[model samples]
Target chain A: MNKELVEKIKNDPNYQELVSKRSSFSIKLTIAMLAVYFAFILTIAFKPALLGTPLSADSVTTVGIPVGIAVIIFAFILTGIYTKRANTEFDDLTNKIKNAIKEH
Target chain B: MNRTFLFLVLGSIAVFASGAIEGEVQKQALNMSAIVMFLIFVSATLGITYWAAKRTKSAKDFYTAGGGITGFQNGMAIAGDYMSAASFLGISGLVYMKGYDGLIYSIGFLVGWPIILFMIAEPLRNLGKYTFADVASYRLRQTPIRTLAASGSIATVVLYLIAQMVGAGKLIELLFGLNYEVAVILVGVLMILYVTFGGMLATTWVQIIKAFLLLSGASFMAIAVMAHYDFSFGALFTHATELKGIAIMSPGGLVSDPISAISLAIALMFGTAGLPHILMRFFTVSDAKEARKSVFYATGFIGYFYILTFIIGFGAIVMVFKNPAYLDVVKNAVDGTSPILGGSNMAAIHLSHAVGGDFFLGFISAVAFATILAVVSGLTLAGASAISHDLYASVIKRGNVDSMKEMRVSKIATVILGIVAIIMGIMFEKQNIAFVVGLAFAIAASANFPILVLSMYWRKLTTRGAVVGGSLGLATAILLVILSPTVWVKILGYKTAIFPYEHPALFSVAVAFIAIWFFSITDKSENAKEEQEAFEAQYIRSQTGIGAEGASH
Candidate 1:
């Protein structure tokens, strides 16, 4: 509720670091996931045959199966990447900022 | 291992709810095993309700389970809240009928989890209380914003609830041989009982149980399908293609259009984040970290479940499609193909029979039925909370009411909602309500998602901007859907649709974002300036969880 505290936290080094680091990290991961998903969608629309074709001549499996699985796997991996960083790096910075505000 | 075993038990209860063992098809005499299975589910959940009633002593417990839920529990509860009968029966039915196109729904639904994890969950957990409108109204005019948000929540919940209820009625008619009215009333009574007495604690446990049942049952079906193919994806595809042709493995006709596909993709992705019921789950956890972790576990569970559905579809393709035992003996004269035992929606049910026989068939059917019950309860709770908490307490009383009185109002609202769901379910029994869910999503994405995102990140957002822009988004989404092919041509029997596309999110969502941005920047009201100034305090609390509401425990 304090105007001075608001100004102080906004200018605090720890707060700025947390915001910048977390926002950029989240934004990059979100864009990556969106690209992969949209690429899959667009390919279905424009280049249908590419996903329809079999992976190899002998196998009955199409290229789309692995790609679909890959998308699911990719989601988990991205989530892991974010969670790992958030739990370790981001939480540490957030705690430091909280403590500093409390002391002040 | 313990968790997996728990899911198996939970999943088996769902099958019991479906009532499949006795009569998947043929109006044969009722089966006792299925009845017993359903009774077990009934008794167990009723016991949970009784236990939850003992602890639900205040408004907080009624709405958020006192924020005492753990990350894993909340994750499974979310899955239960989300994975409706539509996901289990509808996607499998789509896969059974259309093949590879079914996975599009799978992927579209799964992608929203990560977005929520990154942006909405933490800030929402910190800034809001009980409902999403709490956060959206943080620095704005509380009355108008809360009113608009409550309206949006009710619209989405009611439409979605009707779809589920109607689907339940039809499914029960087939699986249990019950009259349509009776089935709808049963669902209504049970949902009211869960929310009115047990509240969020009961609702959370019910969802957790339902999610487990769904995951384990789907897993069992998928495993059985794989075992038949010697655990080889290639073998399953080979067998499936033999029945449906090579297109079964391709994107096929369901998504050939670029515009429609992208529109659908936008609706599913953004809509999940904006859903009132889904957003409400964030408040059940103790902190932002648990909220984040809940999404992580949800994504993992939901992703794994979808992969199983792919197999289940292919399994049905090989086992149930064109198979004499699971089909009508009389063939269609022109098509020369036998109708499936109960219809395409029962494809997963028949596949259970093919692999696990009578008992498993009954089990899967009950799980599908239980899926509907759990989903309906969640939607009811959300709608009730919107009415009592946002509308009555914040707007009418201006936050001056007692907690006990508010809780009483919420229970009354739940009863009203349950009756409304039943009535709407019966009325829309013959209507094509499948597209209604899509319209709900479009409204949520267009109206709620844009306003929510802007309110959090954009410091310049004004009360006028959020209300007007959100109302426009809401209105446009509804209007466009009415003019679109699904409603205009198909439902109204028009020769041609004014709006060519089936989805409205692609256009409406953009309109909302633009409107909110343009209006906020142009506004010169003194209150607007004050609202903008207050954003700094909100931003600090949202980011750092400082001075945010704490868990009572």
Candidate 2:
């Protein structure tokens, strides 16, 4: 580990500017939270209850298949978004920090 | 689309897929060969436990798997351990019941990873060792700080373990047709063996194995589900909407409201980094780098797993609504108000039957049972570690420690906790234990997270601050949970209850943060340097045990 590398990251203006960008996450988190909370409320307000039955027992089976397909499609989108960001943003910063620290 | 056609599809598939020619699950599930194979799996788990107990050699191995697991293995284990009965059955179960409400928890849980990746993982890997308490107590002394963090960690693990155990018992009875008490005892004994014998090593292996199996099982279901839509993304969304209404395909309802959604996400996102057991996995790895890599792997694995759960939940509703037989009973049970389903855990099982038949259902059930075993084993190891390592060696023996004696204490603690879990699981067999498990996360996020975060960043923190913050956080969370209305009626499902706080995580986490700041300011006399040095040593020990695979080794 290089001691001077630690000094550079601690003092470097460029690195400090990058560090300053972290506050954006806190803001993004707020947005994500709002999306979840408001969505939950709106769904209940509009639908109130499932348009179907509660106890689908005894009956052979008619429920899950199509519903699952829907969820799978939605999940693919969600995961695609997560994978994209994790690589582009998270991986980039984490690697930079490691590089700076390792040199130290 | 008619009743006759739906029944014909389901009934014919159910009969043809059984493979036994008998076409019955209840009958073939109890066969002699299957029983023997089940016993073999149980025995293999016990053998590892036996190995753990014999090779105990030192206190370090008992607590942290000698701190030698590679990042990849540790990552798998972390995902494995953290996934639990809740992640496996609970999330999918939620999706099964609530259409989109299930999506709320999935989004809440998976979205949390970005926070850790951006903020906490590396710092936590670099901070104090062993327990989250080690981080908190870095600035504070042992008496109050360590005790509070330990208490919080222990209480959370114990309650969560009870949920896992009781859930296993009931689930096994339903899936395997075994006696309820017998199933609980079976899992209890296997977990005790896993922890008491192989200690952390056995527990880690079991968790890793469980993670792989769970992932594979979920992937299989996801594939079958995608197949139903002919690999067309557009088709899936449209079909799902057709089955459960367009609302089910979308992500909103109660959570669309910002204030409540943000508050809930706060608990979840921060909660992941804060969780003791999850963070503890970082310590199990040999170095800080390994910890980082593990998180990356865990992020990918867990991300995919959550998506699979969402699909499984939707699948249950679609298969039933289309076939009619599945929805008929569920609709009647919940009075046409609930989804065409009765329980969330059933989502995966029902999906298997819909796609493959009773045989597939039985096999999926077996995997689920194995999942409970893997999770419970990890939880027990965690509990035993807190007791034998933190309390026994650190507190009871203080500076002068006997390695062999500490190992023995861990084994005994393992047995004791296992028994206690069995008793509690049975007591709460009928109650919805998921809420109780959530409380564990609440306390962990509050008491454990702050101490860990502060210790890593604030170089000037004093011992008193750690002590006050941890104690205040732990006490606030537990007290609120005990008094909360949900715990009053839902946990034990008791009829008489008062108090209305459905979420103690929201309040307890707040109090903990305030206490940390207040106490740190008040206690200005403690030596900050000494605390930092001591905390680092503990962290090193946690990541690399004293005699095992740590740097010293």
Model 2 chain B poorest ten-residue lDDT run? B15-24
lDDT of 1 by residue, B1-553 (tens): 0111211111221222222221223343464555567778877898999999999999999999999999999999998998888778867876887677777657878888888888898899999889999999999999999999999999999988877887788777777767778989998999899899999999999999989988998999999889888999888888888887876777766565677778777888888999999999999999888888888888888889888888898999999998878876554544567668666768898898899888987787788778888989999999999999999999999999999999999999999999999999888777666467777888899998988888888999999999989999999999998887667876799999898877888899988888888889999999999999999999988888887777767
Candidate 1, residue A75: lDDT? 88
Worst 10 residues of 1 chain B by lDDT: B1-10
lDDT (10s digit) by residue, model 2, range B177-281: 687788888888877877787877788888887788789878888788889978664466556666666555333333433333444555666666766677677
First chain of model 1: TM-score? 0.95
Q: Candidate 1 docking: what grade?
A: medium
What's the C-alpha lDDT at position B311 in model 2? 76
